[model samples]
Target chain A: MAAALTRRRFLGCGGVLLVGACTGGTGPAAPTSSAPPPPPDPLLALLEEREGLLAAYEATGTAHPDLIGRVQPLQSQTAEHVTALRLALALPTATSTSSAGSSSTPASKGGSTSGPAVPADPAAALAELRSAVQASGSAAESVCVSTTAERAPLVGSLAAASACHALMLS
Target chain B: MDPTDALQEALAAEHAVIWGYGVVGAAAADNILDRVRAAEQVHRARRSDTAARLHEAGAAPVEPEAAYELPFDVVDPPTALQLAVELESGCAAAWRYVLGQTDDAELRGVALAALTACAVQATRWRRTAGISPATVAFPGQ
Candidate 1:
């Protein structure tokens, strides 16, 4: 009981010291507008792009079998981000319409879509996908570096996938 | 006046991203094909939503072009991956900037989403390129 009390006392004193060390600017020049804090990193923009790319790929349904499996898992992971964003923005949550079942997709049946399998040119399809995978992997790595609490698994996995893409392409 | 202006900027970014995806998707490998395309679609929808919201608010949306200049030479898969990382990393900075200018919750929401999306894309591209993308700089410099 005495040890517990001592720990509490220490924590209380530490808290005061920590607060003393912190500094808040004074004077009219320093404006801390209550705008919801700006995002610490810029990687979310890339993730948004990836969401579109992933959807386009799924729409094509021509992804390699292994890719198909890998993407589905990644899609699930991305949904967490989708939820976090909605909460942060105080926006309504998107309904899941992605044939992928990850988020609310605005796509209609008639819209023309593109994917890795559809290759703009069939002969160069593998080469193209390999390049894209590598690119996607690199993009994912940057994301990990930029933010504190976003998409680590997906980023790391993408990096690995890019390597795999090169092998598959070869 | 409202968050829509910032939203429009984000839409513009999405347009550019979709364009980049087109180039990379054209040559993405078989295994990662689905992921590449799926991510593109997400951006398209986000852009569309932002555009609509801007239009509703009487904001002029920035139109995306058929193509944009690549940051690096994409002669091969590895090279392309490196370029993709740089491209998305650049994009992340733009969105982060937008997030800073707006205080509207809706804008913040989209900004958060966009930021997260860019971060993920950067990570994937970095991993694919076999480089460590400074994961330590969370929240970014």
Candidate 2:
């Protein structure tokens, strides 16, 4: 079982390598006789979803400074999700994109903001956040149900974590 | 591990969780007794469902021991709440393992739902106990 799991993980890493080679300018070109491109990895979509959730949490915190204490912990957890998803994909550790320029300020005091439109009311903002988390959880569950057993555990954990996040938001 | 073996393990965990919740409910405060009962009920239902699944798969589900050794003495409400958290965490871990041992979509759905339920319940227990960061990043992992 352990060897099987290792092989599955190695295959996942190979997928990431293929993606990287295809996208990176510095990487050598694919051979003329290369096999057909592999199917797109579902983990990439999950990674994007987690990064969006992190951004949404950060925006909510910025919009409602008073709610930062409540939001920061969940945001930190989301950041951890982003990291785990990256690790599952065997991707390089990039600088935290979600933390850039996330300093809390009073600039978005009113209802609407330049970035993500966080509701003016803290309760409403939290509700919105909860909805997003719920949606992401559903997505993760769908992927978990359909993906290979090797990938199911990671997405399954993501789904479970999102459920916890939704409960916290509630 | 075989999927049936994983299911058996999850059933064993559920049996233990149901038993642990008896201790949890006994020591829980009046204000939180409802939550304790609700959690216990869920575990009981899961236990029955898991046993049924194992039987359907032609595998004998693992039965619960006469009693499980408590990780720590459940002497008070705080300890009881901590036990509740621990119970759900165990359930989550078991179901997560099931996820990695099966490719059946229906089984995966069951495992994922159970994992999510346990993770949510664990967060609730943590919040009740005033634990920091009530939600874990990777619940079963």
Candidate 3:
């Protein structure tokens, strides 16, 4: 199905002049309108979970220098996944000031902020990473059920990739 | 979007990969040729299944190209492994789109298996090639 266009503009002056200019900026700059935040995109949760996985990989590498060779690649790939997921979800990587001036705050961070704990042993680290990947795969699968058809493949691939990672670490 | 379109595209990719893997297996090292052949068989099976599914759904499955343009020469074992990597990557990407577009639970399950298998095979090829970061974070993207 074609995606519905959610963004629109109403032009009052014969569809010629800008709506803001014609309305004399009297509508409180569109922020005081008190619109509720959009329900979180399920993909964002997957993305955040990926970030946590990256952090886990990084921490494992730091704690066990001997496993750096293995951990580094996983970390790099996890970071890449996070970046691709953010792009696919149409989310900005970094926070940007809102266009609605000084009074407007950027959207709140929508998902988990916790990172993986440092494991005690190399085997434990690998196990932790594998478990995390499995969880991520499950989460991505859930996102596939809720997202639009345009995004389902990307999300589904993420799940597949996560499973592959788990298999690799196994 | 029609889920069949995604399935047809995946079928096409599987057909291409099955063809490509024949070349890949031919040049692969003795140690890995069996694996390459196995991968080829996997894609062939998937291609057949996808076509059958599309037919059942009342959508005409796409036919494979007469021949595909190779991404690179499959000269030696490394190059052959690289080709396999590329082929499985294409397969994964195609199935990813299928998973996204399909709403049928059974079809999604099929697409998911195709995607996971392709991704695992790609990682194996990457490992055989001694490529860094053998497993991708996102297979299709």
Give the candidate number with the greatest lDDT.
2
Best candidate according to DockQ: 2
Error of 2 at A15 (Å): 14
Tens-digit lDDT track for model 1 on B75-112? 66676566666656655655655555554545544565
Sorted on lDDT, best first, the list reads: 2, 3, 1
Off by over 4 Å in 1: A1-170, B133-136, B139-141
RMSD of each: 17.3, 9.1, 8.5
Candidate 1 structure quality by residue, lDDT tens digits, A51-75: 5545544533354444454344344
Residue A39, model 1, lDDT = 54
For candidate 3 chain A, the 10 contiguous residues with the lowest summed lDDT are: A97-106
TM-score head-to-head 1 vs 3, winner:
3
Off by over 4 Å in 3: A1-40, A85-92, A95-115
Considering just chain B, what TM-score does every model have? 0.84, 0.97, 0.94
Error of 1 at A130 (Å): 30
RMSD after Cα superposition, model 3: 8.5
| Chain A TM-scores in order | 0.41, 0.69, 0.67
Q: What is the per-residue lDDT of model 2 for residues B3-95, given as tens digits with 9 covering 90 to 100?
A: 988888899999999999999988989899988888889989888899998888788889899999999999899999999999999989999
Candidate 3 per-residue lDDT over residues B9-31, each given as its tens digit: 88889889988988887888898
Q: Report how far off residue B3 is in candidate 1 (Å).
A: 3.7
What does candidate 2 score in Cα RMSD to the true structure? Answer: 9.1
